[model samples]
Target chain A: MHFGIISTGPISAEFSQAIKFTDGADISAVFSRNAESAQAFIDQQQLQATAFDSVEALCASNDVDAVYIASPNSLHLSHALVAIQAGKHVVIEKPAVWNPAQWDQVWGAAEKHKVLVFEAARHIYEPAQKIVRDYLVGKKPKTVRLNFSQYSSRWDAVEAGEEPNIFSLKTGGGALVDLGVYPIYDAIYWFGEPDGVRYFPALAPTGVDGAGTLVLVYKDFNVIITIAKNAHSDAPSEILLGRETLRLSSVQGIDLVTEYTAGDEQVLFDSKATPGSRPLSELMRFEAEFFCDMIQAHLEGNFDEARVNRYRSLTLLSRSVNEVCTNARYTAGIFFENETLEISG
Target chain B: MHFGIISTGPISAEFSQAIKFTDGADISAVFSRNAESAQAFIDQQQLQATAFDSVEALCASNDVDAVYIASPNSLHLSHALVAIQAGKHVVIEKPAVWNPAQWDQVWGAAEKHKVLVFEAARHIYEPAQKIVRDYLVGKKPKTVRLNFSQYSSRWDAVEAGEEPNIFSLKTGGGALVDLGVYPIYDAIYWFGEPDGVRYFPALAPTGVDGAGTLVLVYKDFNVIITIAKNAHSDAPSEILLGRETLRLSSVQGIDLVTEYTAGDEQVLFDSKATPGSRPLSELMRFEAEFFCDMIQAHLEGNFDEARVNRYRSLTLLSRSVNEVCTNARYTAGIFFENETLEISG
Candidate 1:
């Protein structure tokens, strides 16, 4: 599987490096607004891929099997539509679109073109996530809390009255969308779509949530998703698995999943996950491996009914997640550029 | 101070044991519905207190200087009122009353009698609590979360369709009153009264809250109080003191108060609060020490202006805390016996 990495941003560089850990998957092309930045990222990553100045040319390249969209939050729809229309499968960034309007447009094009579109929610593909998912099969917990509050590196920039790309409304970047997406996805993935969603954002000076609490109400129990970009807390996220408890060290990137019984502490995940832990770049390998296998099965006409259903459910899950995040942020009085959709919190 | 302990409940027994740790404080009298039960408790604790079946007889005993009201939730007001009216200082248990109306009645009587009325919110008087309080001076946190959840021992009884006193509406007992009081008091004790409060209760089969989430809205930040009695979680309570984070091992009884900086993990509390750690019985010693000092100062008329102000502030704080808890519970669709004054959540 060949991935044409879009944008020369930090995440794009990660995707470029992520291919190293996967089997026979390579970056065939790279795209950037400036040719120099694209070339530089390629050179830094020691990639054999061609660097394209225009996104159109990158999508049009014959060698590219799929285009990995690592663009900003607002540009996800435009970027993916172009790649899908160019007869390429697309692996989009975590949140695929800003609102349902864009969501409908992107999926419509993907369906029309008969191409796959995957949201690169990295943690969902990790082996650790599978352990939790398997443990939650019949014995579902009533109470759950997923926290992914990391003090943003760009928070200093926002504090200095500068709109770092992540802290800007135009870029569709805020704590809820950028950092909240992980826990938001985790909530939906593990416990289905909440019956209702309410967000309490710690709004920033640049009109974005610096940190916030999300009350996602399920039928019986409530899920509290704490997300932040301007503050940090070491509090473990919790899930009460019947009588016992599963304490996840983190929601974003977990290394420790501790389950306590009447006895001592039982560490669920077998491995240390990584020796020194995989570099940030290699962390994206799991998502790449998943997307490549699914897309390749379709290309080779070897996709079974089970594989088809799996891919379909994943796309639908991404669809629901985008709705929850968009609606939650909008309800909390956080609107992207020109977005005025009023969904009650 | 010679104290008459009301009721022969488990808390009353613990109070009798806790007095052993206090200076010149002992159970001068014991009250129970049955004289055998009162006499049995006195024998078990090896106390020289007189056992009284009649509540009036216990309160009217000349040997008792103050009464520790450890009665059932519904009986708290009646028991405390008897003690207060008898010219004895009172130490009522946590969540003393269910509604603001009850709060008004209890305080009104306490003021008229000119006696010290303490809530016996044990954690507030702990040496560790003072450490967190002193550290919070001038450097308040932006996002705070206090969690104290322990699966109740009586949960099996509730599951068996039998209403234990802790799970009964008539007894003025539920998760919010039973377990939620600790975190609620912690919120008010550290941060002042929240501007607004909203509660989302996970109601039990017996129409009482088995567990719940309390959203306490402060001026610049929101404090989340996650409490449960039907389940357990080891998730640490957090207080983001400025840039550094303070992780409390447990809000109910903290053994670890960790503060993290740019360098290494800094354990905040200098000494281990206890060597082998105090028993649950001895945990009540702090509250006994506090109430006894205030009451003893008043009895000798050696109560200086500072002592007067300290006692005044404590009662005022308790007054605010009661209002917050009662209002929060009422708003969350929980109304105790014959009380339904709606405050929307």
Candidate 2:
């Protein structure tokens, strides 16, 4: 399948390289707001691909069969909607969008255009994540803790007051939006939408969350999700599945998986998956292929609404985290640019 | 200086070896209720030391100069007071006694005898701990989380009710008495006594805390401590100073120390502590040498009253955690062997 790459950033470069190595996919085109950045990406990869300066032009291009959206969290709705309208299957990156309104807008457009929309959260596709889900198959998971905190170089810029990008409220950036989404996705995916959630955030200067902790009280198990953009801990990015714990030592970019029993030091099982370097990017490619598969399955009258419902569940989870993050900012006395949010039930 | 080792347990054996390695200390005698156990330790170590079958005989023995009390938590007071009455300096293991009344008795006896009393908490003697203390010389630490939860084999035995030991409330075994003491000590040592504390315990069937969360609210910052006996988490035993955090990988055993700026992942300093060939037993040796150092200093009329006062502070902390754990058990509708703990302060 031919895939269109979006937002020619460092991450996009990694995806393009992974696509070059993948067995069945081709990076057919590149899209960026700046024509030079797109051309630079094409030249760097030395690929026979056209560069489109706008999302509309990229969606209208004949060379692409599906579009991969790696733009900022705020731009996901606009890019996904444009691609769906152009009859292109969609693969959107995390935080899916800034809020549920954008999620609904993108999903509605994808349904009307008969295109598949897959969130490119490679963690969900990784083997470690599968092991976690497998471990919690039948047991009642009573607690979940997901922690992803990486000290970023961009934090230096934020501290120096170089107009904040996605890590600032103006750009829909905060610890919850940027780092908290991983645990949020894990909670909703593993357990289902929580009946309710209590969010507490520690605010940073310049109207963004420096760090935040969310406690999602399920009927049985409670989930604690910690997201931080400013601090570092030795805590691995892990999913605690009540009876056992599924650990990815380097949750930041891990292809390996290990399971630890409730009280044992010895890991029960370990699968150091041979995902050929750049596993995270390969997950992006797999998501793209899955989108094409879902689209074909839908058109041939063999659609699995049950599976589609899972995808819709992803939409709901993505929107829920964005809601929590936005609301946390409001509660922390941080004034965001998008103040007119429609509070949803 | 000469030393008496009370209890022929694993910790005492290790401490005996440590005294042999110390500069000015000798393992003058050993004691246990069972003469066979005391003889076994002497035979195994090839130490030319007198062995006694009871604390009274050991305290009366002229060969002993000081006593290192490594017996179970419940036996600390009786054994330490016996040694003190016989004019022997005493070093008691952590969670020194079952309650504060016992601690007061031991303290009064030591003062009357004009003998030094030491608590064998080895971390305070470690260079890393001194560095951390020096690093925060003038700063009022906002939060201090000291976690020392090792999934002990005794937990399984306690749950089975076979030979219930310290992990059973009937035997003074619980997360608070066993593991919670570390965080309590850290809070007192770093931020002095907290204004208030909130404890959430997962009680065992024996009405002891298996694992739980603790929130210590100080004047400036809130400290969070978690100690679990039934489950394992990769939480570094830590003290989060206002300006930085000092993290140790394990409680009872700290082989490495890392320092991070407050609320940041960038490690300002990390001493990837080199692990020696001898496993956890080496800490006992360090404790022995430090105990002798204090003894000699005291006998030489250079005793530091501040060190003894710090131990008094730790006693107060242990009392507070005891109160909270006892009350939390009641809230969970669990009754233990000693449920009439007066927690009202």
- Candidate maximizing TM-score: 1
True-structure RMSD, every candidate: 2.5, 6.4
What's the TM-score of chain B for every model shown? Answer: 0.94, 0.84
Off by over 4 Å in 1: A273-276, A341-345, B241-243, B270-277, B341-345
Across B60-146, the per-residue lDDT of candidate 1 in tens digits comes to 999998988878789888888888888888889887877667777888898899877888889888778988998888874667777
Docking class of 1: medium
lDDT of 2 by residue, A23-104 (tens): 5667788988888989998999887888889889888988788888888766777788889999998888776777656677
Backbone clash pairs for candidate 1 read none
Q: Model 2 clash pairs?
A: A142-A221, A166-A173, A231-B263, A231-B264, A231-B265, A232-B264, A232-B265, B166-B173, B167-B173
Highest-scoring model, DockQ: 1
lDDT of 1 by residue, A1-345 (tens): 788998888888888777887887888898888989888988999998898988889999999999999887778888899999999999998777887778888888989999988888888887779888887888756578777766766988887899988898988888888888888888888989889888887777899888888888887778888877877776678897546888787785667777885345888874466422566676677888888888888888888899889988887788888899988987888988777642322
| Residue A221 displacement (Å), model 2 | 7.9
